[model samples]
Target: MMTSQTTTNGRLSKRVQEIKPSGIRRFFDLASKMENIISLGVGEPDFVTPWNVREASISSLERGFTAYSANAGIIELRREIAAYMDRRFSVQYDPEQEILVTVGASEAIDIGMRAILDEGDEVIIVEPSFVSYAPLVQMAGGVPVAVGTKIEDDFKVSAEQIEAAITPKTKVIMLSFPNNPTGTTMNAAEMHGIAALAERYDLLVFSDEIYAELSYDADHVSFASLAGMKERTILISGFSKAFAMTGWRLGFVLAPPDLLAAMLKIHQYSLMCAPTMAQYGALEALQSGMDDVERMKQSYKQRRNFVVKSFAEIGLECHIPGGAFYAFPSIASTGLSSEQFAEKLLLEERVAVVPGHVFGEGGEGHIRCSYATSMENLEQAVKRINRLLERL
Candidate 1:
């Protein structure tokens, strides 16, 4: 498919060229064109956005709230976000000065890094985590130092490891409890240690709590809610995972006054405000959406139990995740590299699960299986995995 003309077609910036494509996306693209593919790869919820949430957007359109309201987004949505945080996490933020709506948590991640990092600044990220953290740091011109978390630690990041990784150049500690890929969560006592470390090092913290509402039989201790951490932590969450509003492209960042202003400056020029109708949908979700969240959470809980139990029954050791909708099961027992196991399973069973190494080095012997789908799919994927494991 390649020719000399193609090779010479265009030049990419060194920054762009140096970065590798996302590990999570490769399998996604491959699965898209395949027949009868049962994917446990993508992380979005299988549930449709609730009718009430859709109605809210439709009502907003009927009322002609089509124009972009403010660069900071509409005051009403911001106020609802502030209230929701206080009510749910006990973290108080000023709607006017402390919160900025973003185009999904993805943009919040980018702007948060861009607003603060200078050349050569270092950020410590715990892995295996969401695929974007390290890449975002690099794109923002900061060095990303990954601290690997183990299954024995319940994948809760260790403050000691984080402290050991910090350098004089280190500026931010990015937290992703109810973490992606691993579905791990930290309790209050565990989080206090991380908070203490941040205090000792005087590091800024960015906590992505988009999965806060998805915890199962575990309390999600928000880094921002910990003692003396609010001033230093930028808490980012959105309606995507919990409210089933991923396509709405709505997310928000909460920070102290000065940091919020800096990120807002970048956001204003970059994304303008998030989509007006989407904001309305998010506002409705935040206001009356807890019921839908609870409904989905219950469904995920049932699926989680199913997948974890199924994996165990078939001789695969799976860490029982406390939050989020994924189960990161170790595939080391099969004596196959994560990639090989995933590829073989896909070819043999027509099932798609992400190979863990794509998440980072820590994920090499594991695979991340999302339970955010129908119970029937979960059952079928388990059966397929069981068949493959038996043969191996």
Candidate 2:
């Protein structure tokens, strides 16, 4: 096998070379090989795809519907997504002109950034967030300007911060909520403020709401649903988080017709379309899997409570996450840096959590622990973590 160093291409793209491996991947890789390791590292849901959704994919295969879909994705799926968005969130998007299904939410982010950014443009990223946003921006020749959300503020980014970060070269505000890593979400007021700021600055917004259906106590607000913001916001979401369909790799992007056209050009040249079977599965999910979605959300909510309470008892300052499956807890009192704490926990206690600093600079004193594992695993991990803290 040719090595990366000895490959015929000789040199990798500067963008590819500059990108670091995801921090979340590192702990999971190490933990996976260890006996009795309790991993709260990966962000994927533990639930299997709902039987109905799986049957839809199986049905598609039986019908031989296994070819390249339209570059913009199946029209019926897009229409279903549009209807779901409208019914669930009151967001209006024309299925034909506004939606493009992609390989995953990850691809939607990549295509959205590539379609709008020119060299040297700046994208405002609210951090500590999902690991991909900044690197993706760099790859597209755009600069990522990270705005740190404070723990004191429940990890919500304010309009004042957004206004402060805007420069003449600012092209987009990349927003994620309920966010990964932090598991924090913005309320209607906060989202409206961001929408207002985007309008005031004449900036495009890329809102990642993959966790929209996973909010525990509160409702998830879509930036694109705000008045006037829909025209400027590219909304990214998927079946992975809410429907436990991470392996399905089906997601969609919604934007104005002009923006969708530009993104379709890139999607066509690059990915062609999302997986056909996954698209069919997602179609079934949106149309008939509401009960399944609710079941998964309720399970996550129970897990969230268990983890949060356990962390609190362990003297870790866990900001009760309003959404998503991860818990962000302050580990500063451990007298260990986030990386040090994560490494030590994995090595000694056989519990895996991601270092907060891996998400961004402001994430230094905290760590992200996912509650996506079995309740049995979570209980044991908590016991081990408590013992580790006592020893420290």
lDDT by residue (1-392, candidate 1, tens digit) is: 78875675455566666688997787888788889989999899999999999999999999999998788889999999999998988999999999999999999999999999998999999999899999899999999999998887778787889999989999999989798999998888888888898899899999999999999996667888888999999999998998998888889999999999999999988878899999999889989999999999999999999899989899888889988899999999999999999999888998999999988899989999998888888888999999999899
Off by over 4 Å in 1: 1-10
Once fitted onto the true fold, the runs of candidate 2 whose alpha carbons sit more than 4 angstroms away are 1-10
- Global lDDT of each model? 0.91, 0.91
By summed lDDT, which 10 consecutive residues of candidate 2 come out lowest? 6-15
Candidate 1 lDDT for residue 226 = 84
Q: List the residue pairs that clash in candidate 1.
A: none
Q: How accurate is candidate 2 locally (lDDT)?
A: 0.91
TM-score of 1: 0.97
How do the predictions measure up, each by TM-score? 0.97, 0.97
